[model samples]
Target: MPPFVLRSPEVLLSVPTPADIDRIAVVCTDPAIAEWTTVPSPYTRADAETFVTGMVVDGWARETMFTWAVRAPGRPDGTVLGMMAIGLIPGGPGDAHAGEIGFWTAPDARGRGLTTAAGRLAADWALDPSGLALERLQWRGFEGNWASRRVAWKLGFRYEGLLRRHGVRNGTVCDDWIASLLPEDPREASEPWPQEAPTS
Candidate 1:
């Protein structure tokens, strides 16, 4: 399958290209990202190049995973604000309709809803009956990744519970929070989340 594109009023999502390697490398260098995500510690330019040129490319070619580079509408061909991916979940006995979703936002791009917007777009496309036909989208993250948990909740993913020692980060086992979104779930935020009042 050819590269897919998803766009919203504020953001654009597309397959990562060679030109995005520099931005990817820089973004992955942020300690927060490396700490919470699977990104390599001391992330290097070579890692970014391989991800864009190898993983991203081969994933689409094999139909096993789909990734998108997120950017602002004004800089469609410029720097990426973040990245999102949907991957097939291996299952037994005729079960091939499940997928997992993951994402990370550049440090400079956080708090602007860029990652949330990008995630919404990806989920919409993946769950469409005429698109991937995926029946469920699983979301899992380290237990303390509140930001990621908030995004999943905002996307209408129902909280399932927690898994003990089910996640690994930087080679150490850790607990994980799990959630899922079904085709019938609302695409908009449905639950009330507490937030600090804006100060004038």
Candidate 2:
């Protein structure tokens, strides 16, 4: 599938490019991103270059995963507020149209709905008959990642319970929370979000 853009009132999702390498590198260094995501622990400009100049472009070229660099309107071209991707979950005919969603937000961009807004646009396109037409889009985050879980919840992904030892973080296996969204599902929180445990 060709690279495309998804728009929202507060955010726009477009493919990240070589020009955004610096910003991408900076964003990936956020401790929280590495804690919950697969990004290299010590993210570097070189990694960013390979992502934007290599992986990201190749994902689109091969029609396997669609990743978008999220930014607000009028923001500088290099201002990447977040990253979102929906990758085809390889499976047999019964699961032919399944995909998985992943994302991370810049520290400064937290507490805003931009990530949520941007994600909705991505999911909408993935499930639309005229779009990817995927029957299901799953969300997985290592347990304790309430931030990512909230976004998934707000997007109406039905919580499907945890997958013990399913997620790997910085090399260690960890439990992962899983959820799924179907094309016909209402795009709203399906249940009350669990309150976060207070930090000492």
Candidate 3:
């Protein structure tokens, strides 16, 4: 699928460009991002360049994954607030009508509803009949990533359960917190939010 823009009254979701490489590199260097995501530890400028110039370009051209940068409406592309992705899970004929949703927020963008807003826009597009027409959307994160869970929660994703050692984070095995949303699911959360364990 060709890259396109998804917009809301407050946020705009558009393609990430080479102009975003430096910002992406810096945001990805944060320990929290590396700890919770599969992004390389000690993420580099070269990695960022490859992400925008290589991976992103190929994903769109191949129609395997669609990615977007979340920014405030009318803002320059470099002032990205976050990134979002919708990846088609190839499974043959019907493709199971399934896709996975993923996102990461820039450090300064945390604690606001920006990620949720952007994700909602992208997800709605993916699920629309005129869009990807996906039947199910899966969301996964490291087991302890409450921040990510919170966003998924707000997007109406229902907690599915933890997957034992089902994911990898920077080469380390990790448990995955999984969730799913169907086209029939409510626009608001389908169930009560799960409580997070004490950090201390």
Measured by lDDT, the strongest candidate is: 2
Evaluate residue 126 in candidate 3 and report its C-alpha lDDT on the 0 to 100 scale: 80
Candidate 2: the clashing residue pairs are none
Q: Model 2, 30-113: lDDT tens per residue? A: 989989899998999999999998899899999888999989965436489999898998892356599989999999998989
Ranking of all candidate structures by their lDDT, best first: 2, 3, 1
| Backbone clash count for every predicted candidate, in the order shown | 0, 0, 0
Q: Per-residue lDDT tens digits of candidate 3, residues 31-133?
A: 9888888888899999999999999999999988899998988754649788999998888236758899999999898887889999899889888899989
List candidate 2 segments past 4 Å from native: 74-78, 92-95
Predicted model with the maximum TM-score: 3
Candidate 1 has a TM-score of 0.92
lDDT of 3 at 68: 93
Residue 12, model 2: Cα distance from true site in angstroms? 0.7
Instruction: Name the better of 1 and 2 by lDDT.
Output: 2
RMSD of 1: 3.5
Residue 28 lDDT (model 3): 93
Give the whole-model CA lDDT for all candidates, comma-separated: 0.88, 0.89, 0.88
Q: Report the candidate with higher TM-score, 2 versus 3.
A: 3
